[model samples]
Target: MTVQPYVPEPLPPAGIDWEAHIPRIASANRALARYDGILQAIPNPRLLLSPLLTQEAVLSSRIEGTQASLEDVLRFEANPKEPIGDAALADIREIINYREALNTAVEALKTRRLDLALVCDLHRVLLSGSRGMDREPGCVRTIQNFIGRDAQIEHAIYIPPAPEDLSGALGDWEAYLQGGELDVLVQLSVLKAQFELIHPFCDGNGRIGRMLVPLILYDKGLIGSPMFYISAYLERNRPVYYERLLAVSRDGDWNGWIAFFLHAIEEQAGANGRKATAILDLYDEMKQTVPEVTRSQYAVAALDALFKTPIFSSAEFFEQAAIPRRAAERILQQLREHGIIAVLAEGGGRRAATYAFPRLLAITEGDRL
Candidate 1:
């Protein structure tokens, strides 16, 4: 028997049995709101959230088969001039691009609507200088594409709607994103799966679709900040994530899909909240202890820079930490002696050495990395 290509039904599900999943929906919303409440209280979200965002970029890219760990990324970033294998450098660049794309999208959402234009811009950023660059970085596909292990479309595991149907499908998707009667969480669950099925961009569609999760929730005012980290959950349950998505198209199981998605948001929200709270508490402890440890008037400035970067070169630190060269050198020397920062790699003769904040990296990377 010949296997036919999968074609997704249109958006704004005509008759979903949402009533059955009301309790689950409410629970997920409450969990998300609690996380948002925690995020709302953080005075400087970007500074505190930077590590989590980087972790997110790593996990999300991992789902797409990128092997760069959080440490690899931070280490590479800390010493970009160092010689690294071409493969590792490429993987690290993709991870960095993911973070850059996410930050750009979050900023753009502040002024403009979350429409196709913003999505394209994010795709462009994601593929720049990476392997996906030649696949039409910021544009929708103009030819047929498929998802599978084989190169031939005939053996594809799944095939999205034809290129001609994409415009109408995307227009409908954009309309739903604008406003909808359904609960935002429920609506978001549908939108993510739909976006994957649509596969808007020829390359980086999976990554861009995942990025839409936090962006949609934040833009819809469901979350205080766009710091949700559901990719951790999806990456852990990779098999089930794909299974549920395929079930939606195969069996029209919106209820099952939404339930699974809601669970991801609920569990990951609680986890993200706990991690953020821990990071914030660590920040406070450092704020008090760093000055005591360094015994310098510029300790607070150095502490702030460490919290923001966590992994940095000593030269970059002196310049960006905004402290006098001598003072900065003294502070760094003291920190090294006390083991607050460990030398990852040493540079000789006017070149700065790279250091890592062990506790901070442990918190961000967790046990997995």
Candidate 2:
């Protein structure tokens, strides 16, 4: 017997039993508020939190079977010629696309609402020059698609709505996004699960769905910016994440999924808060350290540039730090000697060496140096 496609019910799914989820909802909200407070306190969140964003892109893509690590992506960006192999390079590009797509959406959200047009725009950026580029980026599926372990529909785990139904389904989803709910965080849980169930795009549905988490939070004014990093939690709990989503479609288990999602929000928000606070503290420490080590007027500028791009080239650092040629070279040597930065690749001839701020990178990776 063939498996029939799963047609999702319209948004605001009935019988959610929101009353039972009150405790989870409250906890999730408190944790998220605390995280947002940390974000507000950061002097330059976009710069300091950039590595976290990249890590999110890596983990989100990893959930979809990509094999690149956070360090792999950063090292590649610092020097594209690193012989990490074609397959690894491909994965890195996908991660890069994820970051670009996210940054694009954040900027677009500044002047527009989170609607389908903007979503399609993000889809285009997401799959550009990547594995799914041929799968019709920026366009909704015009044919049937399914989630399965094999190509045979008989072995499918889940099948999304038929192509003919996508427009109406998505329209309803967008309308629900604009309306109010019992609680914004619980409402977000619904929105995310519904999008995953709908499986709107042909190849990037999972990633795009995850991307919406931060975007929605920002658009709803829950965060100072679209910088939340929830993928770490989801990726860590990969099996349960999918199980909760599937449970919603399989058994009308919205409350269960909402409870799980709220927990994810609460837990990841605390983790994100701690990581962000660590980065801020390191920045404060480096302020005095860089000045003392380099004893240069450009020490603060150099420190800021490092946080913005922890892995950078010597030439790139000079330009970004905006120090004079000789002075910047001296400062790099001083930082290298003092173990403030480590050389990832050495400069030779016209090729500038790559460096890594291991302290900052370790904090972003949630690892000790």
Candidate 3:
């Protein structure tokens, strides 16, 4: 027997039993608000949250079968000419593009509306110079697409909307995004599910859908920064992640999906808050220690760069950290001597020596890296 393609019904599923989810909704909102407070208190939220951003990129891309990690991306950026394999190099580029795309989208939301144009533009940035470039990065699909083992739609596990139907569905999605009065968290949960069901673009739908979580939150003023790390939760609960999404289409289980999303939000928000707090504390300590240890006026800048790219090359640190070359060298030496940064390689002739901040990496990776 052949399986039929799954086409989701339009938005605002009737009779959701919203009252049934009141507790989860309230908990998610409280967790998010607490996280937002922490974000507001950070001196420079972007700079401090930089490593967390990279971790987010890594986990998000991981969901799409990309093998790159935060370390891989920083190391690749540190020395693109290194002897890494082509496959690993491509994966690193994809991860870097994820960061670039997300950063671009967040910056755009500062002055622009969150609509299809912004989403498409973000998709363009995501696939540019990566493996998915040929899949029509910013363009909505003009052909049917499916997710599963078989190329034939009949054997596929899940099939998105027919290409011809995307315009109407996406239009309704964009409108609902702009006109929802439901609690923003619940609204965002539905929006993510709907976007995934539509699978707007030919490629990068999963990644772009995940990216929208933070984008929508920031756009709606629920979070001061778009630094929410949600993929970690989804990746941890991988089976249920796909199951809930499938249930939404197969069983019209919007209530169950929204509940799962709320639980993810609540749990990930708490974890993100703890990680952010720890990162900020480490940054504050380093701010004072690095300057004193290096005895260079540029120590603060160097420290900031290290926090941003904890695993990087000495040369890249010198050039991109916005510190004088000589001062950067001195800071690097001082950091190494004080056990703040560990040298991964001692550059001999032409190779740029690599470095890593163990404490910072540990904070972000949390014993996993």
Top candidate (lDDT): 2
The best-first sequence of candidates by lDDT reads: 2, 3, 1
lDDT of 3 by residue, 235-349 (tens): 9899999999999888889999999999999999999999989989999898889888988878778888998788898888987688877778888888999999998878878
Tens digits of per-residue lDDT, candidate 2, 1-369, equal: 566776778888898887798888889999999999999999889988999999999999999999999888887887776577889988999999999999999889888999888999999999999999999999999998999998987898988889998988899889989898879898899999998899988899999999999999998889988999889999999999999998888888998899899999999999999999999999999998999999898898889889988998888888888889899999999999999999988999888899999999889887322
Angstrom error at residue 220, model 3: 0.7
What lDDT does each candidate get?
0.87, 0.90, 0.88
Relative to the true structure, candidate 3 reaches a TM of: 0.97
Candidate 2 regions off by >4 Å?
A: 367-369
In model 3, the clashing pairs are none
What local lDDT does model 3 show for residue 164? 80
TM-score of 2: 0.97
| Candidate 1 lDDT | 0.87
Cα lDDT for residue 173, model 1? 87
**In model 3, what is the error at residue 349, expressed in angstroms?**
1.0
Clashes of 3: 0
lDDT of 1 by residue, 184-270 (tens): 888999999999988888888888988999999889888868778888999999999999988887778878888999999988888
